[model samples]
Target: MPLPTPPPTLLRDAALFLDFDGTLVPIADRPDAITIAPGLLPLLERLQAALAGRLTLVSGRAAADVRRWIAPLEVAVAGSHGLELGTKTAPRSAALEEGLRHLRGLQAEHAGVLLEEKPLGAALHYREAPGAEDACRAAVTRVALSTGMEVQPGKMVFEIKPADGDKGTAIQTLMQRPDHAGHRPVFIGDDLTDEHGFAVVRDLGGSGILVGEERDTAATHRLRDVAEVHRWLNDACEEMS
Candidate 1:
């Protein structure tokens, strides 16, 4: 479905939380294959300034990885689906280590399965081998069960992390901080894992923007693709300026 027409006025007082992959940049077959847009850094910098540093990137990727990908333009990030919050590193867990080992073993067995290690978790990506999705899911599920970790499914990926953390918890924690307190939230994302974020923002009397095809979503609005997201964001910046 097409996105609703852009709003006339931007919410300068709102706190912004954006998902990186598929929302900020298009999803790549390989996690490392993604390319950031040429002017994204400047745009985010402007947006962050306008919002009083309330802009944050909330992604399933590691916070360190996110920072490296968007280097030289520092911004708050919640990585590992919120397991690693802000600049603080997640504490090492035996469950995570064991899960990683299990996933690595699966990666060796499956031709196209890739294991992405995180500070507190791991992800099994099977985008290159769609046919192996079932096997990958099963392998991750088995590991999650044995290691007492949570299984988070996203676009062609399965992540195993501690059961306590999620995007909602991350956003809520940020909202309580001095920089974000009392501000309305506006989260935009493009994956099922982001549903928790959407629900949290709405419950806080904010809004959620969904990107890509229509489905059962918690988002209040929709944008067709990454380009539309950029257009909407640019328009919002212009309006506020």
Candidate 2:
């Protein structure tokens, strides 16, 4: 059956988690190349307040990076695919170093690959080098097994993040906080990496709304794309008001 659209009352008692790329904004050729909508900041601020400060942006980028992109809007954010909480990242790991080295070598080999260095791990983006997908996947998966890091595959990038945490763990951790008490989790995401989050929200008696094309996803609801996402949020804000 096709997934249902979330009702207007979905945000009534929600602790909302939103994915960044391909959800809040369109995916760009380069991560830094994405441009935020002029009204997005205000809309997010309104939604955050309407939700009683239970809004968070869950992304694979560093928390600091997301903060830079949505500056002056103070909302909760989890980055590095939820491995990094807020601006504070975990200490670098030996396995992570090895993974970074491996990615650097791969970047050298595939000049078109862009290596994004993060505090917890690294990502090799092959959007500019679509032909290097197999190489990138193989390198990351190989390094992950040997070094015990996690290989996160996305639209056109392979990320080597710490194996310890994922979007599920981050949402779980956030739910445990006093502020999240009595609230149901509602995750809105648009990537394969977001599967973990969808599963967790379902387990928590909340809902998951997937963006983009339909697939065998854990999400129970669907939004067409970022524009629909904005409409949903706007409707949510209105209903919850």
Q: Which candidate tops lDDT?
A: 2
Which lDDT value does model 2 have at 222? 96
lDDT of each: 0.87, 0.89
User: Residue 121: error of model 2 in Å?
Assistant: 0.9
Measured on C-alpha atoms, candidate 1 has an lDDT of 0.87
Candidate 2 C-alpha lDDT tens digits along 1-241: 9888889899898999999999999999999899899879999999888888999999999888999999888888898888777555557767767667887898999878999997777788999999999999998888778777878889998888777889999999999989897899999999999999999999999999999888999999999999999988888889988
lDDT accuracy of residue 86 in candidate 1: 55
- For each candidate in turn, the TM-score is 0.95, 0.95
